[model samples]
Target chain A: MNLPRKEWAAALCALPASEVKHLANVLSGELEVRDVALPHAGLGLLNLRDGAFEESYFIGEIPVARAEVIVRSAGGMEERGGALIVDDRAQFARSIAILDAVMAGKLPGSVPAMTLVQRGMEVRQQKQIERKKLLTATRVDFSLLGQEDDEDEE
Target chain B: MSYVAIKGGKAAIDGAASASEYLRSKGSLDEPLTLAMIEEQLRLLTSRVVSEGGLYHPRLAALALKQFQGDTLEAAFALRAYRSTKPRLLESPVQDTANMRCIRRISSAFKEVPGGQYLGATYDYALRLLQLDLANEDPAAFKAVAKSFLRDTPETELPDNFPKVIDSLRAEGLLPPVAPSRAAAFDITRDPLVFPVPRSAALATMARAETGGLLAMAYSNMRGYGDVHPTVAELRVGYLPVMLPHPVTGELMEAGEVLVTECEVVAMYEGTNGDELPTFTLGYGACFGHNEVKAISMAILDRALQKGMQDGPTNPSEDPEFVLLHVDGVDSMGFASHYKMPHYVTFQSDMDRLRTTQQKMQQKESEATT
Candidate 1:
């Protein structure tokens, strides 16, 4: 399942210590996971899976946007970061965990704060889908292709 | 939502991620190392990173390795997924073999090429044993063995276009007439393969197919399946140029180079026409990265699948479904490894079926006894 960076990070960081330890164990089997500290960056880890790993960043006990996952291979390192977007329903289910945990008091932070963030992210995703629909709906305008100019002249 | 509610899925998933991280850390690395070290020190492995991962950047491969602490396959997967997102910078033109910068060149046809016979580095005549002497840093011994091989070599000018042996047969009317023009070849990368893929697509599918999967299928074919006798006509491994049209000038320009290995095989087949003459067809294979065995196997499989062949060959290569579907690393790796995820639901279903089957069998046995 493909999860957005923000949701993946939030899900990872907002876990209670028990859940964190659980994830740590699962990740450890196939990867050499490492934690790193940046001056302003929140807690994150270097996840080494399948002989390669990506750097994940988090903020304020919340997973933030713009977390770069760098993939290394034969030619070299490729850093990929983009909007916290998701395509698959399975991914959406996977991402809802941390927010759910926060809501259930299994994780830290004020309930309102976590709820607000969750709602905001969902709104952002909804807006993007609407924008896509709008663009697609209007994409067939002949004027945009410059054919309308000839019709007007005629 | 369905009647079945997924309880504690969030908690379970979160736990899984942490456990994964912990396991990866504990499993792989006992020492701390940076990406720079892997890139600089382990160049061979780094090359593997590119080829397997399908990413051409060594620096990135190194970083990924450092992050993963030498988990090569993981690094490769990460790279491959990332590679899909990157925009293509340019389209490379098909390179001609004549123009290849000969870092190493050899021919079975004559002793030497036009430039002169340079044995280059080849293991063909060698004893196939790993040289422990090379570990002792003996450059002199390396030169001595090379000189001995070239001693009786006939010096000759290399043909501008090396005549392929198959083409020679075509000229003599021994084989089917050479096409007036080279037919456009089908490639798997450009199109999804339907079953009964053409020779070109079949080769492409095999070329990048996972090594282990191909090896297994080839082994199956050799054990028994269909008629296949493979003789390697030629095998060449070297760098090939990546050229592209210059956006401004529109002239083809050299962009870079990638290493490749090509293997050609000849297999006997019944004539396509009504002549009833014994004939042979060609199997061709080429792949990114320097793996000749994979190429050779691919070539053998390619020729085996041609029409008008005897049915004794039982190899997996002779079966189009077996050969075409099982070679790609992506599908095989994903499907094979996905079994690691939770299968409780499937397992429960299996249990229910098993109990029912056993009850029915017992009832049949009791009825028979009565």
Candidate 2:
């Protein structure tokens, strides 16, 4: 689903972009939202950490772009019974953590395999970004295609 | 970027169930509760749950204890509340009275007739103090006692499934066809009772009626009002193989067995709808488990209500809906406990109405004085 960057960030935390859109629509009808923003962090684009407990989050000015936008939520009282929009990027990031934990033999069950697939997809996207940059810069969208994603470097 | 929402609504319900389970099992890891244990230890409570829940499985009631955390009343509430969500697995159609597997059968009639009277387990109207020894005794001991009684009277004739007393009346043309015709084929479990129920539904209602309430109501009628003295025409208690129609085979198949207490009472009936002199009419009772009191009370009420109809409202027992509906255990308990829930919304509405009425009354009083 299509989503703005701020929404994409929140979705990365928990919900998918499509679900976030639905929540936004529902909330807009119920209560007015003042503002939304995506803050910077030590990593590339500061994204919400993935966890079942974390849902409700905030995001501010940014327009929609490329990416499979899924809804996610910030972990908070507001997100207690709510949903948010997310994307494959955020899902993959979370899956990596799950996979890392599983490979370390800390996590249990099929959670590792599932997240490994997610991390692999994200790595493939990183490779495509490097090849794209070699070709042309004008065609690259930093947020969507992650033209020079910080995570790709590390 | 705009913040968007996410998550599944059903996850909340799962979380709730998990939380409930955790709360129930906290701390207690030993002496886990069992169905037989509940039936034996908490017999009265189990009986109440079964009576109200409209299901007679003691084990299910015990399982409900785990779900509701050993709160007998709440367990009963849960049992009934969950009943609506369950699909009826099988339908045990009405069996002919002559087909019942009679374990303990008896008749108070003369020495014998078609089937000789059998004293299955009669304290014989003697109210003896309940022996405390039997409370925690091994079940095998009780079985041995019954075995010994049977061995002592090897030649004693035991009555099988005696034909229904009502059938005999029907054959003699004493009772109107309206009597037994209504109950010919009935399934009470599947059907919610409609008001002014046919005799079939009425019988089913009494069959499953709670013992204490039923006995009280029946006794009230007997003491002064309805005057229904019914002789035990027949009584039976035994395990019957519960059969159901197979969807694939399209044939009857035995599911399992359930113990049942069945009793029928014959009372003198004055002719109705222009008939001859007074003849006998039947009051029948049957229920899950070996609850003879419930069965007998049910039989008494069955006869009283039918007989009292001739006398109108003067006979309180004649009101089928009143007796049948109110005497239900679960319905009674749920309704009684429901009052505890906050009704602030409805209460506020009533308070508003009362204020307006008071204002109106004050205005009228001043106007009259002026």
Give the number of the best model, judged by lDDT: 2
The TM-scores, one per candidate, come to 0.53, 0.53
lDDT of 2 at A111: 39
Query: What's model 1's TM-score?
Result: 0.53
Q: What DockQ does each prediction reach against the true complex?
A: 0.01, 0.01
Clashes of 1: 62
A-chain TM-score of every model:
0.26, 0.20
- Locate the minimum summed-lDDT window of 10 residues in model 2 chain B: B246-255
**Which regions of candidate 2 are displaced past 4 Å?**
A1-154, B1-30, B40-48, B65-76, B111-194, B245-253, B272-277, B308-311, B345-370
Give one digit per residue, the lDDT tens place, for model 2 in A1-154.
2222222222223333344344335433433222222211110110110011111111000111111112222321121111111112333332322222222222232232334334434553443343222222211122453555556532
| True lDDT of residue B96, candidate 1 | 51
Docking class of 1: incorrect
lDDT, residue B16, candidate 1: 78
- How well does candidate 2 score on lDDT at residue A24? 36
lDDT of 2 by residue, B98-177 (tens): 55555456656422434433444446656798888877988788669645644454342233345554455456766544
